[model samples]
Target: MSTLRPGRRFRTALRLAGIAAAFAAPPLAAGAVHFSRIAPLTGYAPAPAFDAPDIDVPFDPGKRTAVVVMSNTGTELTDFLAPYEVLAATGAFNVLAVAPEARITPLGAGLDIVPHLSFAGYDARIGADPDVLVVPFINDWRGAANRPVVAWIKAHAGPGTTLLTICGGAVTLAETGLLDGRRATTYWDFFAWVPRAYPAVQWVQGQRFVDDGNIVSSAGIANGIPATLHVVEKILGKAVALETARKVGYAPVAQLADPRFTLGMSPLPAVLLANAFRFDKTEMGVVLHDGVGEIDLAAVLDTYPRSGTTLTRLVADTRRVVRSRHGLFLVPRWDFASAPRLDRVVVPGARGALDDAPLAAWARDRHGVGVTYLRGDLGAPLAADRFPFDLTLADLARGESAAVARWSARGLEYTPEDPAVLAGAGWPIGIVVWPMALGLLGVALGTLGVRAVRTRA
Candidate 1:
């Protein structure tokens, strides 16, 4: 197979990485993948060994343990701080920042933090028996030199104690063979390296976080806070977890399975940039067009930034077209030629109610055929009077929609409304979409002509 070329997906990721680099220094770690959104669970099977224990940890108000964080170059400081602050607020655990050497760590934005402990001159007695060991992300400090840190974790964590690592930090833990034969997750990038180095470990490609008994692994740096929150909830309770989220700007929907809170990398900047365009998500596909008027094919082709364009871009760049399983879609420009012909039609009434006159006309006058009108607005009656045709309008009674009725009438039926099915097919409707396209096209052209005349005169 061919190796590769500079592709759209590649450029977008590079641009996003560039923006992140401007905020913080480039990561010194070899290779770590930032995570996207987590995929849905496909299968469910119970594992007795993976079940949570019924017994609780003995409450000791003063018996809190600190998570030793080592700040290195390109280390995500917020990844460390978010969890540190949340853990502290719980009034259950304290955090002590440490470094490889006995010196101050220069965080991003000139915020200098002194290392509480140093590996060169290490002493665990200063801090309590850290019931939980958390390895904050380190962009550098890899290879044999990390043996001491790995040894310390193996020695310190007791049978009852738990060990946790976030993002690239998990790579360090994996080096210790503690993750062997265990299900784990890291920011998506390090996936290649983790499995290559630790063959025994089971790498979950799309999970936000996976709990293997006392060991917990999380996706990327973005999920560090939530992963720590999971630990807080496990050690403390749901009440404390919810309270911590409220204290921060985080939502309290941190159920162990919810990856939205933690699995993906920060999509704020990218989403913000994309939101500048009028994003219209339709049943057919997603449409990005000029909000001021109907879809301008030229503008769509010219206006979009190549680095930040979507997964699917239409030929006319201004509008992106997508289709669902049921043949529903969204397109910036109404291109009947690019759309599918529909035998069934439904028009909506004013005030967003359903209207059936158009369907009646299409069925009766144009062809001696029947059309099932599903409920939706068809805009103004552009040719409702002239193209008056005959059609039958049937109100879909409870559990009596055409889809079901068709299935009942015939053993098998056709569904034009399945998003997944439509999306997969990438079917275009060129012949039957003339009405929708021509009306919108005329409006667009007229508006442009008016603007041009005003500009010249």
Candidate 2:
């Protein structure tokens, strides 16, 4: 196997890291993976092709832990990023994304991630032995026989390096045969499948995390936060882990517990900070396109993030780039040809909304497609057209009587923030999403109701 060359993904990560180095940041006790929103591509023209400027900068090297996050084309966005952010926040680890090759690795949420080093380049650049190896199961976990990831894990797990897998990540690690006799747990949704898939491993459920000696495995998406925090505590210490938790507004758990049963109502502002607690969520897709128009994605996605809902970006262009009209450059994590299973897909409108046959067809074919228009005065036709969008973000954020009724009249089965779909904290406490049957009754009764949970208690 060869290492990463000074190719596109390599140079992009290096250049982005260069820009992050310029910011004023406090030095850590050891090497750390610093993060920042990458600067908009330089000298970017209306054309797709562009050149990167030569830059001279390196990552900080004072952090104690060397954390390597492995990603391929379809790793869960929350699985990789949540751990990266949590570990990096502690200023205790030099976290990096490593791949079999240095290329644009597509991850969920319509975002592309650049691997800092290839597995073959690890010893030369980072080191032969890292403090920790973090693995998370991605969308395309099956079918690849004895992939490089398995080979790498087989070569690396031992004394001086803690090996960990998050959610479905354990499944990938199991294929390596290290967990054959070891006890483990995975996302509860796959409780039955994993045991059947990897019969040698002792697969348990209900535990947020399971630690059998050197290997630590987490239950599901948000569940990794606590398990990773525990690893932080082991290496860095209780104070640092606690501080990291506090600073991030997360309360750390010391033991394994299912997130589904621990659902807590939260405030409106804090909704953005909490993770969906479900352990059985099906992944969803948020499509990104060229010159994509804004639908306040962050604003509209307020209810989905920090939750168990696994939302990933799916793009279908050869250039493999999706830029918002507002100038935010978004790299798609999955192109259409390789896009994985998405229970739902949300498409924000662009000027060509009416003309994109593929986009319309894709959404129409999929279950629970969502559409929201950021550009106002799109005329009633655009608003009324059933191009797969049943309601606006406004109807989701604040349900209006008429709009809700209109949707009820259509008998559309999809409902935003449906607990059955995803129990995202975005829905307030005490709220009930009227089912289609009840909606029909509501239309006949000429009366309506509202219920959304509020306050944490």
Candidate 3:
């Protein structure tokens, strides 16, 4: 199915404002009470739900055209893999991951990879020029390790070799003087920053890419997929680009023409959740749930579909695949270390508390700045000491959902285990269960009466 359009995007933005207004009670008096006086995020308001991307296009390896992806120690996985996977699936290109060193290179998150070609190794071993050179976003644009790779691009990649860059990878290519004084684009989060970094290059906004004949640059990590689709069209044909996009369940957008890259990045301090886990929502909603065990988040993902604030799942470890309580596996967008800075975090409750020390450390470090959500035992130490909110889990669970509103400003969403364990659950399932229980009792009684009459006869 297609994604939500601009109108719904606007409505969701407004709905988020409404949720924030609902939760923020009483005027903030000058010097009387601070904004911190508000309770910790208790629970989330409801939102339109959406299914995570599940298109599994089969890989077909045929054409041996050389496609080399340049990387360093801290390459963003999505920026590299999204385009690499798209190109590899076409069976048209031979993809190789090349780094600066011969040894195994550690990547973002906890993942590691062995390079197919090192800067010097490629020249001595393969010795042949590749048709396409892909540069992924790295942790730092001006890292010392990237000097060799930049030199390689400068020497070989020009006019004949199609050099494609994802997000901040443009900076790497720009260092070669290739993109200098040429139209280019980078990740939206750094839309302004990139231009400031290299004023010589004309950084274009409101578009997915700036394809200046031989070079191609994309907006962000997720936007890389669309940018690569444009490349597929350039190499293979329009038919292939459309076919690849269709098989992958993504519509092929026009080249050099995606305006969405500009609008969302202006807002900072957005909420960032680890992207993973399948939820039972209909449309892509605002609030997110990152499952730690075999736990179902159907009830929890219900809140904040239209929540205007940002919500994403961040992988805390090397693992991108997350298995839910029902064996639902999902790949998240961001990992812990590389995730964008945001206001607060929401951790869903599971059957057992996971030993995620890194998350605890991050929370402890940002105790005053951001709210750290811990469902059940997960929040024990953090909440007990720095329980800055006027409300508690117990309070929200017992009282009406309105009490949870205090924490809903940043699109707070949660699913507590055993809602009945509390005085009463504020969700729909908690309130609707009473009538269903009475109906079941009446049905049993009626059946028993009929059996007794039959026995008498």
Q: Which prediction has the highest lDDT against the true structure?
A: 2
- Where does candidate 1 have its weakest 10-residue lDDT segment? 38-47
Over 1-457, each residue of candidate 3 has an lDDT whose tens digit, in order, gives: 7498989988988866644443332221211232222111111111112233342212224444444455554566556655665676666776666667644443333233445556776677555566778887765557786777778877767456787888778888888888887888886557657777788999888676778887888776556667788888888887888776654435435532443433312111111110111111112111123443211121122122212122333344433445432222333344555454544454544223355465556645743233234344322433322211212333333432332322231122121222332233334343234334444555556557657989999
lDDT (Cα, tens digit) per residue for candidate 1, span 188-288: 66776778877888887655567788888777654666777788888888888888766543543444547533221232333222222212211111122
lDDT of 2 by residue, 202-250 (tens): 9977666788878888876656767888778778888888887665435
Which stretch of 10 consecutive residues in model 2 shows the poorest summed lDDT?
Answer: 35-44
Off by more than 4 A, model 3:
1-68, 252-262, 265-457
Show where candidate 2 strays beyond 4 Å.
Answer: 1-62, 252-457
Q: What is the TM-score of each predicted model, taking all chains together?
A: 0.43, 0.51, 0.48
- Deviation in angstroms for 93 in model 2? 1.0
For candidate 2, the per-residue lDDT at 422 reads: 22
10 residues in a row with least lDDT, candidate 3: 269-278
Residue 13 of model 1 has an lDDT of: 82
As for model 3, its CA RMSD to the true structure in angstroms is 21.5
> What are the lDDT scores of the predictions, listed in order?
0.42, 0.52, 0.49
